[model samples]
Target: MIDPSAPLPRPRSDLTEPPDVPQVLTGALRVLQGRLLLHVSPARVGYFRPQLDAGRSGLVLCGPNALQQARKLRGAEQFGGPLLVDPAVYEVRAASGDEPFPNACEDTFAFDDPLAVSLAEQRAVGVTAPMSPTGYLHAEDSEALKAAVRQVAALDDPQVVFAAPVDVGWLREEDSVRQLIACLRLVPGPKALMLGGQMDPLARHPRSVDHLRRIVAEVPGAALLRTDLAAFGALAAGAAFTAFGAGSRLRHIVAPGEKAKTSKNFSTSPHVLFPELMHFFLGKTLADRFAGAAAPVCGCAVCEGVRALDSFASNAGDRQTRAAAHNVAVLMEWLRTLTALPSGRARQQWWHERCLAAVDRYPLLNAQLLQPNGFKVPPQLKRWALAAPADEAASARADANDYRRS
Candidate 1:
């Protein structure tokens, strides 16, 4: 339990997957091989843990509510992969108009409740590494927000990353951004997760993109708790690590207490990332999108000969797992390429060239498909292509580095 009067704790300085100095922060940029992570939904944890173990793909993460499975995750394999749980406590904050998040356990207590910390500690008992609970921003630099960051940083574990979802709109506020950065300095490291923000990650907004880059570029190593593919763009903007949900459902996140946008897409089916387009497409839509066009072929283990969907069909009953596996295999391959680059600058340039190539492919692919209005470049991809040319990223930050499929 937090004693409001107690002094703040010192955090462990080592924040890498196995703990290493942050090149992105210290300007000692290196190709990050050991610094890798994958975020998966609680349901897909079983599938990703083995993949991470076999490929040694680094850490895996899930939400605070995933603690209930601690019993099942006991022993050598218990609690899964060199892992960390996101204490998404911000959902407990009250918001007007929006419906409450259905899965939040923190709604039972006040955001300032010391009882909240004890509850989180109890839940974190068997996990690989404990994270202190944090909540969403009710307002910029809200005292309650500051208190929550302090509370999480004060947790017994020194490896804790100060993870929180600030409304992306507030990022445009200079003072609030400064204050937020100061608050983040209190933790072992800063890692920004944009959920329930006023702007979409790919809206191509200049100010929000620059501000988001500032927040993430501060401590690039602690990016393991992300839920969207846009987080991949941060690497181009100078982040040290990357992780996203294993499926579409897990990749996009809404703010706490805010009503999540409902999609007609099936939650159980994997949303395959079309590497050339840098967009997630449902199976049938993907097949239809490239119907007559020469579709991209994935040579990943799950999709060796034919198209990914065809490969998934032949696999039969386990389509979800197969598609999900293929998506990850494709992503890991991309990471492997980026990691093998000699230095950070080389990776950024290579990534920019890759995004530029993908953005170029959209026009030809759309033309080939005979679509009346050709597909538009995903704004994040468009922005990233222009944003990631080494020194230029800081002046106009953008982050659209989705993994490739071909």
Candidate 2:
């Protein structure tokens, strides 16, 4: 499990910009292609770590506040894949002086340079980017933000990627996002990690979807973190690499001061991922559906013949954890299917067909269940079916070069 209270180490001198990125990190990205990674949280580590050792990849994303957890990764040499200690320095109300370090797990992060803390912590944890820490970029403070990014990208270490956690405004405003991309381009790196903040789990917004396509087009070695099922679309859109959060909290990064709604009754129920529909449904809901006469059976590894996903209905924490493990497996299985194709266009085309089939089933499932209001198609599912993949030859090349696992 991720130790949320992990602290960063003091500044060190070894990372004057390493000349080469280790093969391990590079290999993970190369192998990702149309496959996906997981942005894992603490409770689910037990479920995810085994998969990582068995050839799956995952990322342990932390913010300034998550340094305690970040610091601890030092002793764990091989953590499945890249472990990012994100200095989520961008603020929704920076002008108002409310929580300057929005990524803080607690209030431990001092006003001192969070980028520096991340650099030191990453070094301690064995991440190579001593010179280039992913910097915070705010348009209002263009010169300062760019300078910070330039400082990190200056050495252009092979392992140092230019990572940017986007603000919600950029997603809502297309021009702003374009401007953000232009800035990102200025301080170029071999790779760039794009972390989405305050967006839908599946990124239903057309503008947001358009922005992701553009980012993949414009940014070098573009990657995605904390994008939930949107990772599927990003991979389809040709992002070098992408991730889905293990649970709802990491699905859409909440703003510093935002208040998220909660439901105690269903709070502990696992939000099961139904691979066929490419939608998440409450455990109890799926259990109830399975109880019906004409309910569908999941054929994924998690629910192969003789075992039904209906076992996930209980509100028990352990049951929820088990259900979540199944969720990861279900999605991973779908991605495996997508990546099994020989080319990018083939995978994208296959993804679209699956999405269309998923969209068509929502109504069928509703009718079968005999409920007036049954499964409603997620706006993201609809969007996925309607959107075309990056089919141009140039796009295929870009995706191939950018998503190289090795």
- Per-residue lDDT tens digits for candidate 1, residues 1-406, read 1124333322335333312234342212122223456766556676655445334354444554455444355544554444555555555553222221112453456444533553465345554444444555544535655565556566534444445555654566666655655566565544545444422433524565556565555533445345554555565445655557675535544565566554455453456767667666666566656656656787765577575442332224777666776777777767677767754467668877888898888878777778855567767677667665536654443332332321
Position 395, candidate 1: lDDT? 44
Q: What is the C-alpha lDDT profile of model 2 across 40-102, one tens digit per residue? A: 654456665544423445555543334455445545534445555544443232311232223
The lDDT for every candidate, in the order shown, is 0.54, 0.56
Worst 10 residues of 1 by lDDT: 94-103
For each candidate in turn, the TM-score is: 0.74, 0.75
Cα deviation of 109 in candidate 1 (Å)? 9.2
Best by lDDT: 2
Off by over 4 Å in 2: 1-35, 53-56, 63-80, 87-112, 128-148, 190-204, 262-264, 390-406
